[model samples]
Every structure is written in structure tokens, then in C-alpha cells.
Target: MKNTIVVAGATGNLGHSICTELIKAGTHVKAIVRDSSDPLKVDALKKIGVEIIEVTQFKEKELTPICQGASCVVSAVTGLHDVIVNAQLELLHAAIAAGVPRFIPSDFSSEFTNIPEGENRNFDLRKEFGQHLEKSSIKATTIFNGCFADILRYNTPLFNVKGQTVAYYDDKAYWKIDFTTMDDTAAFTAKAALDATTPRYLRIASFRVSPNDLVALSEQYKDKRFKLVDMGSMEGFSAYNKIQRAQDSAGEDELYPKWQQAQYLYSMFLVHHEALDNDRYLDLMWSKVEDNI
Candidate 1:
């Protein structure tokens, strides 16, 4: 439709992909960046003819004008949730002021609004923020697309061959949860933002996979079986303690980035070992991954 779209945090993994998707959809895309000095990613966006908006600091006064006449804003800014929340609040205020039609907050982790523990202090910040958007008369869509499958390679030592074996909730036990590829998540989010009927909470699963299934997939790729490492409740807490100690020794400045710490302390915020039975929502699962492994 050639609607003007602004993608905040366009340099991040999800942001980059979302911006790319918007461009591919023939939307006039604006890549908003926090750092002008990082030209590599900026250059990539420029190659695709995406307009660039670099801000040394986030200011509502500055962005409000930029968002004027825009159709939608897809926020893929990952990292600390608090900083993201604050920045998104600024974005929402600006979008409302600018009369932007729709605002999609970066709710990529899970359907936090549906989870019992998600409504509380530990995990409901983003959920509540979505509510705030509705109260303000903005059409906002929240997508819950489970964990980034790629994060498993980076976050868990279990998948890193050079590190300790992949650990799970209990040794050799599997937890069923939804997983979506980064590209799929980006594409689906863009689709949701543009779809007029898109609900406030958009739940999706490109694939319903479990830790056990992933282990099998990895073994298939490597042609070897790795031993399963177990991290029980106590062990999980021990790992958390170790992470906390590391963060403490490094100093408050280096401590858990708000999002990572939030994920650690309140993992219930994510797509856990529960199955999603929402049939009203389309599954939109990509067939490539199904045949890949």
C-alpha cells in the first residue's frame, strides 16, 4: 500500500529483519537508529532505499513530527525491557500526537497477557504497557511468537559445541513450546500491523518444537549425539546465582541488561512448556524449517 512505516532500533536483529520485510512489502520504510556512527547496517538499509533517521538521544519532541502521516510503527527494539519500555512510551506518545494509525510494541517473546504470572510485577510490564496504549485510543497489536530459535545457539551452552552440554529443565526431559524463526517473526509482525482485524494480542507459532525435538534436530545436523545435561529447579537457581554474581562483580553498570535479567528472573514471561490451543488464530507455519532438519 506504500504506507509510511517507521522501524525503531533498525540495527538490531529483529529490527533489521522487520525493516527489510516492510520494504519488501512495498512500504516506504524509515530506519530509525540510535547511533549514526554505525554505517554498516545503515548502509545496508540505504542500499534498499530505506530512509534513515538517526537520533543521538531519544526525544518525543523530535520523533513526533517524524511519525506524522505515517500509517504504522513496528518497534523491534530488543535489549533491556525497561529502556525499551521507556523508549516505546515515548514512541507511543509521539505516534498518538502525530495521529499515526497503529503502533506495534515489541511484544515478540510470548502471549504475556494470557499467562497468570505475566499480569504481575515480574513479567507484566509490557502487558500493562499494551493496555495503556488501548486506553490512550491507539490501535496497538502485540505479537507473541515464542523465543527466537537463534537465541538457543547463543544463550544456552548446551548448543555450543565448545561449551558445556545443552541443559534443560530436567535431564533428558522435553518441554513443549512454540518457536519461530527471526525472518518469520518479522514477516508475521509486519502482516499483523497492516491487517485491520489484527487483535491487541497476536499469538503465533512457526513451529511447535520442544527441547527434546531441538536436541534431535541438532544431532541430525552434527551426526553425533551429545549427552543431555540436567538443570533442576535448584540447578536453575544456582545458574541464576552465578549469573547474578558475575553481574555484581562487573558492577551495576554491567549488570543484567534489563531484558536479559527480566527473562532470567521471570522466564514465565516466555512460551514455556505449555501448548497453545488457540485455533482462531492462523498458524502460518513455514514449511522450510520442517524439512530442514
Candidate 2:
């Protein structure tokens, strides 16, 4: 297949999932890993029929040859400016230099493009990279899969497993919040990587679950009556997040600080993944809110 897909950051959770799905689909995946990457992880990839290339630096010249003959490059690297904007930019350049026709950045998050900039720090880094991608010669596809469905089990303020509460703010009780599983996102991205007709943006969610529905589903699954915890207005939550950011300035060096997590919560309620392209790949089965609970 001539390295149909080259995946950077292929050892991470979402990255590994993407590679697994691609290999399952019988596509050749060239996984880019760091020289310091764990041997166990590298061995796992090799066992799965992936070509793992370990590199010391993420330079364009060094990666171009690794990306050569690949139809597309999908980056699953996650982090702040240094990793998100810097590493992905190098990958983008390498893809272009390698004559790869398509690329997908590590934008697997909520509908940040629709949301205003600076609202979320992580999304801000992605927005920064979007500028570079806009002028690139290679074709780009940004997949917004909302929040990972795995968070549903984490018992966040949204779905508190310990408290048995489905939390919400303002009139968002009925608002459908998007949640896509990692495997589901991977399956779709794998399909997209091979499809030449994929557009520049794709929004997908395994479950556009509502607060009320979540509560009901939890109760049905756990056999316990779950409470609806109304946290107050969305504007009030935003204000609280601002206060948190101001108080947690020490977390500026941290990747996901307390305030940053609050920002993610705000984003969950702010925008939605609309015009979903989930139906584009019919063979993939999406995880449901019930299954997650």
C-alpha cells in the first residue's frame, strides 16, 4: 500500500486507537514515535503490522522521508503550544514535503472553531495552528469529535458517579452535548484518512447526550435514581471559571490546570458538533450513552 497513512504520536491513547483501526482496516500505517518511546509500546505497534520510526527531532527534513509515499498524515499528538503548534507544524511541513496529499491535525475536541478564540487554552493552541494550516499546500481535515465519551464514567460535575447526579447549568438541560468514544473517533478518522473526498472539517459524536437523558440512562443502568444537579446559569459558570483562572495563575506552566478543566466544561455547554459526518462511514458502530454508563 506504500504507506497509505503516516501517523505521528502513535503511542498515545487516541493515537494508538487510530493506528489500530487503520491496521484493522488493512491500511499501511507508518507510526512516528520518539527515540525515548517505551519499548513495550513500540513492540505492540510492530506486532500489529505498523512500521514504527523513532526520531530524535521533529524537523521537516528528517520527517519528510518517513512520510514519503504516504497518502495522508494524521497527528494524534496532544499538548500545549510546544507540542500542539510546534510538533504538528513540523508534521504538516513533512507531509507537504513528502508530497502527501492529505493531513489531519490533532484537533479531536469540541467544536472549537465555532467557539470564539481564547476561550479555551488548548483550543487556542489549535486555533494558532489553524493559521499555518490555512496557508499550507496539502489538503487538511480537522475532526471535531466533541468530548470523549470516556469522561461520562469519570463522574465529572456533568455525570458524577459518586454523587449519582447529572449536572447542568442554565437552560442546558435539554441541550445535546456531544460525546464520541476514542475508538469511534479512531474508526472514523481511519476511514477518513483513506477517503480522498473528505472535506476540511468533520464533526462527529457517538452520542449527543442530554443531561436529562444522561440521568435517566444512569438510573436505568445503575439501578439507582440519579439526581439532576442544577449548577446555576452558564454565565455564572463562566464567571467562576474566570475567577478560577485568576486564582490559578500558578497553573500557567501546567498542561491542564484546574482553570483549564473549567474552561473545557464551559466549552462543552457553549457549542455543539453540528452537521455531523458520522453517517459518512456506515460500517462503524458508535458507542452509546448507556454503554458508557
Candidate 3:
């Protein structure tokens, strides 16, 4: 029987690619978006033959019907940690109620297990969500894709290769982190969802290359000399903890509620030198994109 997969936040880059990969693989895709009233996103999805469902909110009761006959569920929803936790919980309940067998949560970040629960607020919420999943009958897997490599194209400080400034690492010359493209992440996720056996956590990355190497690549490709400047690690573990402590003191209703929490989630690769690759299953899925680059 062909799998019927319902994707929450299907209009997103990751979610859309996942749907496309599944559709190409002969799976039925039901794309769930917030507002079907938005013609552009909905029209684009409809053009691809994806069945669309409009959801005003993400409550468990509301979403139950959205995922009614799905064999699996994938969420790419991004927002505050609390909002994510609540929506995931609601989805879990809805999935279980709808008899959906598998769920892939919105966890395309770092290794949450390496970071302590209380130490980083955002991860603590994820840990709680994981615990909830464990207690449920439905199978769940979380993908940690390190950092999105294509995000570097934006020239942001986080993945800086802009002009003469690389931000966040103490030694720009020595910093090494794992990165995976969104296309790779989507492909792996689609393959994983199709398989009957799935693990709890999957870390997907094409390679772990240093910023210096990246700058060298840019210089080589662009044919221009580029200087690498260390931004002094202002977004590392210590700074993350400081911000967490400040948020705690100020109360949860502050303007930037979970910005530091999100920071802690992003900084795990920097602090902990653990990069994992599970080849037993991921290798087969990776073959499709192995020759793309």
C-alpha cells in the first residue's frame, strides 16, 4: 500500500521538499498549511497536485481532522520553544487519536541530548517533548541536521562568509561544525518516513567543514582574497547561559521570550565536539543526492 503522509507547515522550504520527494517516490501527500486563503502558497502547492487543508490554529482537537487518514506526520513549524512544544504535543495527541503510526518532529537542529535539560531552556522543552513521545504509542524520530549550509548564502553573522567578518567562534581558524543542505535533510526525512523501522534521533549532515575551509572555498570560487575575522564567541555556551539566567530573572513574558533558548540550541555543535552519522540506513537514502554536487 502506498503511504499517505500529511505534512504540517507544508508551505515551508523543508516541508515542501519533503512533500515533493515523497510524491516523486509514489507516496500520497496531503499538505497542511495555516491559511488556504493565501493564494500564492496554496496555489503553488495545488499546482503540484498536493491536497491542501487550511488550519487556523494547531490545537490537538482542531488538527485531529487534518491528519485523519494519514499514515505519518511531519512538522516543519518554527517559532518559540513553548509554542513548538505545545503544537507538537497537540500533534502527538492528534496523531495518536487519528491512528497515525509515525511522527517526525520539527527538530532539525543540534544534538539535544548533549546539552543538559536545565542548562539550555529551549532544549529542556525539547527533552520534555521527547519524553512525551516516548510515553506515547506512536513512533517518533527527531532529526538533527546541524546547521543549514545554504543559510550561508544569506550572509548572516551566524554562518558568516560575507566580507571580512566571521562571527561567534573563539578561533575562526580552528572552528569546525557539521552542516547539511535543506535538500539533503528533506530527502533523508522522506526516506525515513517511508521505512517501517525508524530510530528515535537521526543526525543528518553532508560534511563537517571549518569556517576557514569555507572562506578558502569562497576565495577559490569567487577568485578574491577574503580575510577571516573571529567574532570572539559572543554566541557560545557561556553567553547562552547568561541570557537564560537573565530571562529567568526577568520572567517568561519578556519581549524576547526564547531567543537565548534558541541560541543554546544552535550552540551545541560548538561546545560539544560530537558529530554523529548513522550509515546503517541513511547511506541508502543519501545515494540519491550523492552525485548532485
Pick by TM-score: which candidate is best?
Answer: 2
| Tens-digit lDDT string for candidate 1 (1-293) | 47888888788778888888778878888877877547898888888878998887777888888888788888877544455567788888989999988888877776566555422232355765666677887888777776665655564543544553555664334655666788888888767656667666666666766556656766776566656666566345545644654565443333244434434423532335344423443554453444433
- Candidate 1 displacement at residue 220 in angstroms: 2.5
Give the Cα lDDT of each candidate.
Answer: 0.66, 0.89, 0.70
The candidate maximizing lDDT is 2
lDDT of 2 by residue, 1-293 (tens): 34479999899989998999999888899999999999998899999999899899988889999988998999999877889999889899989988999999999999888777657888999999999999999999999999999888777888888988888889889989999999899989999998999999999999898889887887789898789988998888888877887888788779889889888988999999667998998888888777887
With a 3 Å backbone cut-off (N, CA, C), the pairs that clash in candidate 2 are none
Consecutive 10-residue window with the lowest summed lDDT within model 2: 1-10
Error of 2 at 194 (Å): 0.4
Residue 271 error, candidate 3, Å: 5.3
Model 3 lDDT tens row, 1-293: 87789888778778888888888888988887776446787787777878888888778888888787787899876655555678888888999999898999888876767775455555666777778888999988888887666655655554444464444456546566666778878888888888768778777676666656656665665566456656555346456656667757654444245555446434633443364654745354442212211
Worst 10 residues of 3 by lDDT: 284-293
User: Which parts of model 2 have CA positions greater than 4 angstroms off?
Assistant: 1-3
Please count the clashing residue pairs in each candidate, in the order shown: 3, 0, 0
